[model samples]
Target chain A: MRAVIAEDLALLRDGLARILRAHDIDVAAAVGDPVALAAALEEQQPDIAIVDVRMPPTFTNEGLVAAIEARARRPGMPVLVLSQYVEQLYARELLLSGAEGVGYLLKDRVSEVGMFVDTVRKVAGGGTVLDPDVVTGMLTHHGRNQAMARLTRREREVLGFMAEGRSNAAIAGKMVVTAKAVDKHINSIFMKLDLPLDADDNRRVLAVLRYLQTD
Target chain B: MAREDADRAALRDVNWRMILRLEASISVGIGLLMLIIWALAGARHFWPAWVWFGLAIPLALQVAIRRGLRAPKGHRLLAAHGAITCVLASILLAIWLLAGARHAFWPVWPILGLGVVLVGHAWVRHALPTAREQALADRVEVLTRTRRGALDVQAAELQRIERDLHDGAQARLVSVAMNLGLAEELLSKDPQSLTELLAEARSSTLTALADLRTVMRGIQPPVLADRGLEGAIRALALDLAVPVTVGGEIPGRVPVPVESAAYFTVCECLANVVKHSGALQARVDVGYRGGVLSVAVRDDGVGGASLAAGSGLRGVARRLEVFDGTMTLTSPAGGPTVVTMEVPCELSSPRT
Candidate 1:
């Protein structure tokens, strides 16, 4: 897959580009600052865009804005956002646009090269992959909600993995449970959340996120 | 200024001494002349005694007035009044005795009038403050309050830093150390788990670094040192989700303590803009004029922001209070929010 990277730090930007290249992913353009990121996204039209939450000219959330704008210009355009810190508020804002083909992770996750590469490829393939930290934050925030209060302990655990864009098999592997048990847990979670019983994993993930996003 | 004041006081003292010496010499010369006149005119009826008493009374009154004038300002008026009244009363009583002790006691009336005047003079002296004194009192009150607030904020900040470090990086490092020890114990026996343990240790180390960085940033941002307030704020503006237009010139650097307080205040306001205000754009204007550094952050967002909400803005306000700074928030219900903060400070020359 072809990707474009937007990171202000030269070290991190080169590091990301090098990592992706080693993973056999082509980095079409790697640029610093939001203005250049916007131009590169427009010109390259790469399969995915990896962005930092902070970049020039204002280092606050320009990268997040650029990614949202990129997706707005091209709906479902895959984008992975990385930051030193992951705020639930920023995650909510990012998901508000659309959950599909989006990934928000902390920069620390890049140390896990295998997982980082997998997440990038997953996002490029139009999957929703949120950082576990972001998922944990969301769960803590919404834990007391009426719908969330109805979830069993095991079901809540399953729901967290689901929110992190894990497949049933992957969730089963992590939980050390059989695939059938993981499937049953997911079905129960969907029912408790009052979501439709969607069979597609990606759609199911979106549905679960939509339910979580509600007040 | 001290040297000039000392010189002026010395000159006044010399003048007072010269005047006293001249008065003394003149009185002696007059006394000698009177005695000579009495000795030459056939000594009888002792009328020269009256002349001597009259001259002594005026000299005594002059000395009293001069001394009263030299007294400190608050007591000067009262002292002068008392001195004049005493001299006048004594002179009147002497005249009464010299006039063969009047039976009606007429001196009491004049004495009563002098007492009333002196009382009024004392009242006036204590009742009002001079402009300089009033200003000084006001400045002392402000300094006392701000100094206490500064100390309180500083104490609280240090406590928070300690708590954060203890719970965050320090705890993480302990975990990392434990993981390393475990890996060492399982080095050969469970080589399979050794890699996992090492990875966990490395991850904890990274987390500790992140924690340390956050704490360091809270204490003092490196960017703030590299760029002064204006430049640092400009850098901050670049990081926001909405485009922020930074205007005005600061000319030079504000004192570091005040600058940090102001910068954090601006950061808090901007954070509110991002979280609470659904504004499309924001702007920061900074300027220094009339010895006050002014910063105003305005957002075209949903308003209704208030300090009473117990938001972080209240903490920011308290922090600014330590520097004798002020914050004003104007956020109407419909749209547009403006936060203006001003600190009285002087800017130093820009660092080369």
Candidate 2:
């Protein structure tokens, strides 16, 4: 899988390129700055673009901007953004646009190289990987607490399963209940949490998030 | 809170201010004397004048060294400016005196004294206020630091609440919820016990969640970050009973620290306006000027507000001082109270 890396620090960029290449992922172009990363991506379109949250010139969110630009150019290409800290607002901006095929992780996660690569691979395969810390921080907000309060104990248990990406059957099996019972629990959760009961692949994720937020 | 304690705090700030003024004025005077001596001594002969200039260099450096001394709040800048005047006056006075004062140079002393008269006049004009203002400034600082300390305590309380939810209440609730689900399934077998257990669990969950939400709101409001500053402040203004007209345009995105400071300042100002001022309306203005973020809160209330009374305004002054910012409160006995705070924007570009 070919990838373009945009990071402001030369040492980090080179180090990340080396690590990715070691994993047999082809590093198409490694640029120390986002402008060059953007130019390189235009010249040599890669399968995935890994960007830093901060990059050269206007270091604040330049990498995020570059990733957005690349996605704007090619909607299908996956992008991974790495940041130093858990910024809930930044993560929300990324998720609210669409959670599919996107990854936002802390730079400290790079120490766990295997997990970092796995996350990257997940994004490339059209899956979302939000930093668990970011998820926890966002859920800790006052509004989320209010929402969480409104959930039934059983519904809240189902949400924990759903947040782990479990299906209705999987959740029902875990709870030792019938699939119909699980469906009832989910419908109750949806009504209580006031979430849009839409039919979509990502609705489970949305439902889990809404449950986590309110109840 | 007592009269004696308030008087002592006022005295302490005044003492610091006096020391600042004295050190500044003396340094300037000595430097001036040195410059005059150097000029006269040097002008006696060009060769010796250079020697006098060399002698004045050490004194000039001494004055430069004094500039490094830390002065309290507004006094630092004033002290430094006063010292500067002495050095500049010495240089100009030396030239005028050495040249024999025969030409248009005599008027230089008046020009030099103009700065002294201007600063000294302003200094003396505000002399009664200098002590009170310095006290108020110091008090505001103390209050802000205390409030920040209170905030830290509040944040700690939040962390504890989070831990409590995870380890104490949420854990028990999870078990209760699980047991309730089981109880619901076996309701026909033991309807009475199952119903009681389920009811107990439901009450426990609701109480735990309510406690968690109350604690979390103190840390940060989700709406503030969600809808941005305008929404946050608008929400705040709505809560205020007194008519608070909030003016000034908020940027689409302000630095988090800047917004936090601005938010608290407005909150505190309105609180003060409500608690102390018998006012009809208060206005809070926030905007950026010359790369410095400015917040001005004005209340058309019965003023006579003094920071010496350990009013939280003193704390406000100190909080602003942390970022090299300032808070000025002007409250006349009968009318409007205007509190202005300005903070420098020192954004270190994160570039290689």
Candidate 3:
């Protein structure tokens, strides 16, 4: 997979590029600012773009804006945003842009090279992968809502993994349960959340996230 | 100030005593003249008694006026003035009675005038605030506003610290624990990938430490606690992309709260200089004079910075305002930007 990286810090930018290269992912361009990032995205049209949340000329959400703009120009363009901190508000924004081909994770997650590489690939393959912190924040914020209150503790756990873009089998592996049990929990979650029954994992994840994002 | 007030009170007392003595001496002289007139003139008619009464009237009025003047400021002054008016009216009535009963009661007009004057004086004195009272009231207002602002800033700082710890280092450590758990699960079955998992877990620990250090710096920079504001700022300036010249002397330790607020305000300004101003170079000047500590940050850059433009400087201003401090920005377009912040506070004695 070929990718473009936009990170203002030279150290972090080079480190990200090196990691992707080690994972057999080609970094087509490594740019430092939003302007250059935009230029590289247009010129290279790489398979994925890993962007930072803050970059010059304004170090406040410029990278996020660039990523959204890139997807606007080319729909379903995959972009993984990494930040030192993750805000629920920002996660809502990135998802609102479109759930497909989107990822938001903390910069520290890069230390887990295997997981980080897997997340990048998952996003590039048109799957949404939200950081666990973002998912936890959303659940905590919406846990008291009437619809969410109906979910059991185990079902809520299943829903959280679903929002993190985990398949039923993956959730089962994490929870140390059989895939059949995971499927049952997911069906229960869909019913409790008042979401339409959908078997496709991506569509189900989107439906669950859209429900959580509503008022 | 206490000693000065005491001296003023003593001088007033001495003046009052001298006036009393002078009035007594004058009354004595007038009495002697009246007695001489009674001895020389036909002694039976006693017209000299009228002269004696006339002299006593003025002596009585003088004593009353002096007593009125001696009362302390505020309502007492009005009270004294009222007393003097009443005494003078009584003296007028006495003179009228001693001269033969007046057909029209003529002293009533003068008494009415005096009453009007006394009422006017009382109203004026009661309505306007004294200079000292106004100053104290203003100080109270400032204390109330700044006290509330300080509490708000403190609470916000604490909340931010809590959030940073929870989201930064704490979250990273949890991830590290998860990685270790996964490594343990795979130890015997997937021993080949165990090495990579262990390395990742170790790296996670280091990242957690880095996150902790960043959070600690946000709370209270160790450098700032070790060195004063000047030294701390100098250390900060060294790390900036653009060269920053820090020129200042903070001779003694400032109260820790004020020092922290000042340090953060300066840091915010410098961060603006780096992130927005696009300056090639910057300068910082710090000084304390007349109980006011002032810091000026100047950068030669694109300029046009303002509180309304971004929350960065506005946050700084709010932080300073918690200490009754002020921030002034002079960043016209196409030139240098200068931000001057002043906080009035006393410093401890110079460190030995």
> Which candidate leads the pack in TM-score?
3
Cα TM-score per model: 0.55, 0.42, 0.57
Top lDDT model: 1
- Per candidate, the number of residue pairs that clash is 7, 14, 0
- Model 1 residue B227 distance off true place after TM-score fit, in angstroms: 20
Tell me the lDDT of model 1 at B16: 79
Per-residue lDDT tens digits for candidate 1, residues B1-352, read 9999999999998997898888888988888899889888988766776877877887889878987887886678778878889999988888787777856789999999999999887777678777788999999998888787778878988999999999999999999999999999999899989999998898898889789878977897655764678877876665565657799999998999899999999989998998889987899999999999999999999899999984689888888987779999999997799999999998999864
What DockQ does model 3 achieve? 0.01
TM-score of predicted structure 1, chain A? 0.94
List the global CA lDDT of all models.
Answer: 0.84, 0.69, 0.81
Candidate 2 stretches greater than 4 Å from native: A142-149, A152-200, A208-215, B1-248, B251-316, B319-352
Give Cα distance to truth, residue A51, candidate 3, Å. Answer: 40
lDDT of 2 by residue, B1-352 (tens): 6999889977876886687667666656765776677687764544445446545655674554366344566566566666666676677777776666678767576666768665785566456576677888988987787678657645765687778668755776787778788887878898888877776776666556544644444455544544445556765664565756677764555566655665666677888888889887778887766778787888889988877764567655655666667888888889788889888874332222
- What C-alpha lDDT, on a 0 to 100 scale, does residue A104 get in candidate 2? 81
DockQ of each: 0.04, 0.03, 0.01
